[model samples]
Target: MEGTIKKLGQTEIYRGSRVHLVTETIQFPNGKRAEWELIQHPGAAAVIPVDADGKIIMVRQYRNATDGWTLEIPAGCLDHPGEDPLECACRELEEETGHQAKKMDFLYKFYSSIGICDEIIHIYVARDLVKTEQSLDEDEFVTVEHHSLDALLEMCFQGVIMDNKTISALLAYRYKYKL
Candidate 1:
């Protein structure tokens, strides 16, 4: 179990601001050799901010990868290696939605794309929100919106909320709060 797979070698194919692509040569436990195209990621944190009125704060922003707008929870990548995921969630919540959380409870973590990427996103439920000024990146243009938890869940089922992190986080929150 300890050394099931051995990395024989790896070649960096591309390096970008958020991710890097690499081709890895791996030796499996049964002596099978294979080449895997892996997308290296720094990880991220996502927050479902629930305010006093039982509404979840969300953001609608244009995603270049999809060439369209997406409704998603506040999320951001780890600013640097080893950064605390909870802190990142809190920062992203305020920066994206102009809301500061007094309490942040961890829900779960998952890989966004298990087949080709190693991007682990830590999800949390942020409660007791306080209003603040949003601090978005220079290129970020987001519209903050609040929706009922049930509505968000319906959106998830209706395929309106396509962001994996948002859908997962909303389901987790619903289970945790029985909403």
Candidate 2:
């Protein structure tokens, strides 16, 4: 198990601000060899901001990859390498939603797309929100909205919420609070 796949070599395909693509040659357990293309990412943090009224703050933004607008929790990539995930969550919540959390609790961490990408997302539940000024990146255009937890759960089941991180965070929050 320890050496199930022996990495023979890897070639860098491309490196971008958020991801690094590479092709690797590996010898399988049965002595078969194959090449695999992998995407390396710096990871990210997402926050489910719940206000005192039990409504969750969400962001709607255009995603070029999907060619549509997506409803998701406030999230951002680990822009500063080696920065704390919780700090990133707080920053993203405020920057994207114009809200600051007085308390943030870690919910879960998972790979966004494990098949070919090595990007792990750390999710947190942010409570006791305070209104603040929103500060988004120059290229970012987002609309902040709030919905009840139950409504969001219904949206998840109805295919309204398509973002994986948003779905995961909402389900985790439901389980955590028995909602």
Candidate 3:
């Protein structure tokens, strides 16, 4: 089948360090046209750092959008265009959790918010980690937390972990490996 929607043009409304806002003019297959506002993102990578005892290292931080704290897997956007996702994951793991992974296994990648944003999140499981010093960004204030895989699975089920990427990665890891 042919592509369903054709993008006629896009106008930039705003641009920020992490995301940009734009209005896109699209023509539907039914010959109808509409303008849609969307946030464009550079994409990101997240890592689930698992220690030798099988505890996953997580990060807790306050989110401005949510106006509250969130527990999530260590994640960050690609430093520049064409940066490898695995590299980003490894860097983020060490920066957020002070653990460098000796074994990085990619789990999956998906569009976290396909409706209003074009952000793709790559997920990985990091193991055989070595202790290191955390190198958080100047603006980042993250606290490291560790928990068992089963505990995280329960948190996901109980809606305690609300971050989409964290939930997705946890569920995917749990079922993918039959944990």
Output the worst ten-in-a-row residue range by lDDT, candidate 3. Answer: 1-10
Instruction: Report the C-alpha lDDT of model 1 over 1-179, residue by residue, as the tens digit.
Output: 55588999999999999999999999989898999999999999999888898888899999998899999999999998899999899999989999898899999999999999999999999888889999999999999998998898898899898888888888887787787
Checking candidate 1 for backbone clashes, the offending pairs are none
**Distance from true position, residue 88, model 3, in Å?**
0.6
**Candidate 3 TM-score versus the reference:** 0.96
C-alpha positional error of residue 59 in candidate 1 after TM-score superposition, expressed in Å: 0.3
Error of 1 at 166 (Å): 0.7
What CA root-mean-square deviation does each model show from the true structure? 1.5, 1.3, 1.3
Question: Alpha-carbon error at 96 in model 2, in Å?
Answer: 0.2
Q: For candidate 3, what is the lDDT?
A: 0.92
Runs with alpha carbons beyond 4 Å of true place in candidate 1: 1-3
Cα-based lDDT for every prediction:
0.92, 0.93, 0.92
Off by over 4 Å in 3: 1-4
Candidate 2's error at 45, in angstroms? Answer: 0.3
